[model samples]
Target: MSLFKKKKDELNYLIFEVTRKCNLDCQFCYNHWKRDNDPKAEPVKEGYTFALKTLKTVFKQANPKHVTFTGGEPLLAERVNELILFCRMKGATVSVITNGNTGSTTEFSQLIKVGVQLFELPLHSYDQAVHDRMTGVLGSWKKSKDRMVGLMKFGAYVVPVIVITKQNFSQVGETLELLNNLGFQRVMLNRYNLGGAVLASPEKVLPSKEELNEAFKQANEIAEKRRLQLSSNVCTPHCVVDPNRYRNILFSNCSTEIRQRPLTLTVGGDLRFCNHSPDVMGNIFRETIQTILEKSSEKYSVVARPDFCAGCMRYEKCRGGCRAAAQQTGGSFNDVDPLVNTIKENEETEIA
Candidate 1:
């Protein structure tokens, strides 16, 4: 027999962190998007050449069908276009998630020409002031808007992201209308994850359960009217916001689909447990994808339904809410997600 064994699960998607350097300072940003843009700033110890070599091996071994280039802003990475082209050469369809602050419209067109099939950007609100304030930068909304329009002109499938927070939750419908008017057929609405900058004071940014439900309600109504396909970034607990209530929304819950999971690779070649968690499970440079999966099998196995979720019909779909959220708030992956369990517990106390 061969030294390496073929794993049961094949990697379908790969999330590649091109760089952590970013320009904008959005309030609800989950990751620490570093502003290391100065010429005087210290250089990265590990060069891109080494990263490229590791990525080549990963692509050859994993052969993921789709790859996403994300970062503080992927455009800031050295020779980013070349990076996208390399992935294209490896037979993976490329998608770039950017802030649209670094590159020009012409650069975006060149990216699409070089086989970047998708572009995902943030458009927080219809109002210019609201968006600029959310990003903590003036004139950013216009820049993002221009890039979105320019990408559409070049026949690129652009998915505008609307992060639902207390600040922009009420304007979800207005934002959806704006995206539809901009000629986008699809949009992604993200629930703010309780991590990074917001971890200190989640209450300041996280939307209440009522706000979340209403936001989804308006989003569904507008999507149905505008014929827009809806998708989400994080999965809300079923108890917090019932998934069945939304008609046009596509909810994402990796916990429910543990066997076929998409992998996230940080810039340093470390494989993160998930998009939300900062925990590193393995490094792509050192281990094959199959080895990482086998060694981390116990971690993945411990993420099933909680005891209270024994007979719940939504267990299969929700898998007791986001595993990262539960681990962050309740201190265990098996613990019930505080986003739901806290509210449910309070209601029971009142009944008693």
Candidate 2:
């Protein structure tokens, strides 16, 4: 039997964390758990040799159709162009999520020349002070905004990302307006999960269910009016938005489906289920990619949904909400997601 029951073509998305270093210190960064103990933990600015070896394994095993280069910041990786070129040579289209800090116009041009299809840039809020405060950097908002504009001029497809948190939830309208003014065709708004840096400060960063629902409602309204494509992470429930209007924006919450695609290679050569997961299934340097994935499938098999979830109307699509969020907050992957519970409570209150 195949390690992946699905055909090879089904597993065609690979998310490679090219490096572990980042320029800005965002307060709610999901990768914060990686920085827990090491005082010397700075971004691994350059690692061509390790990266090349890892990419070789990925190409040999997965031969992905889409490769998303993420990191502390993929642009900060040494010889990143070479890595992007390697993916292109293997017939993979590439995209990158960066803090929008590094890279000259020439550097970005070179990357685009190598077939980078999209650039996902972060934009926290319209208010510079709020953004800067969340990022823990004095001038990140300006730098990121400037970079977004510069990338747009370069004709790179850029999507501005807003990681919704308590600090920025209320400003969702203004943020989308700013993105629209900047001429962005699409924007991504992700809810802050209780992982990484947020684990240390969930109370400070994570927004309440009411806050998140309201923000999405407002943002969706603005996005529709401006004809901007809005995408989101799996943290929100379908009930939060108009299902008919935002059907495409709602994401699947099934770990099984997610695990079947998008193999993640960390900077240290560890294969992860996702960036938010701390579990290292196997090391690509030591084991074959196929072998590593097989191990991951066995060890990280999908969690069984609770009985209550089976009867919910949105059960088929939502699949019991985000597994990582449940694990982080409720201490088990199978625990009912707090967001779902919150929505249920709201429904009960209304009925009462």
How well does each candidate superpose onto the true structure, as a TM-score?
Answer: 0.88, 0.86
Every candidate's CA RMSD: 4.3, 4.4
- Predicted candidate 2 versus true structure: per-residue lDDT over 1-352, tens digit per residue: 7875534433567789898777888888877344355332454424998889778766665657788999878888888888899889888899999888788878888887776899999899999999999999999999899999998898889999999899999998999999999898788888876666666557798787788876787787887788878887654455554345554354445457544545677766777777665556788778876777766675465547656576667755665665666655535555655556656667899999
Question: Pairs clashing in candidate 2?
Answer: 21-43, 21-72, 33-196
Worst 10 residues of 1 by lDDT: 32-41
Task: Report every candidate's CA lDDT.
Answer: 0.77, 0.75
Compose the digit string of candidate 1's lDDT tens values, residues 82-119.
Answer: 88888888778999999888887667878888889889
RMSD of 1: 4.3
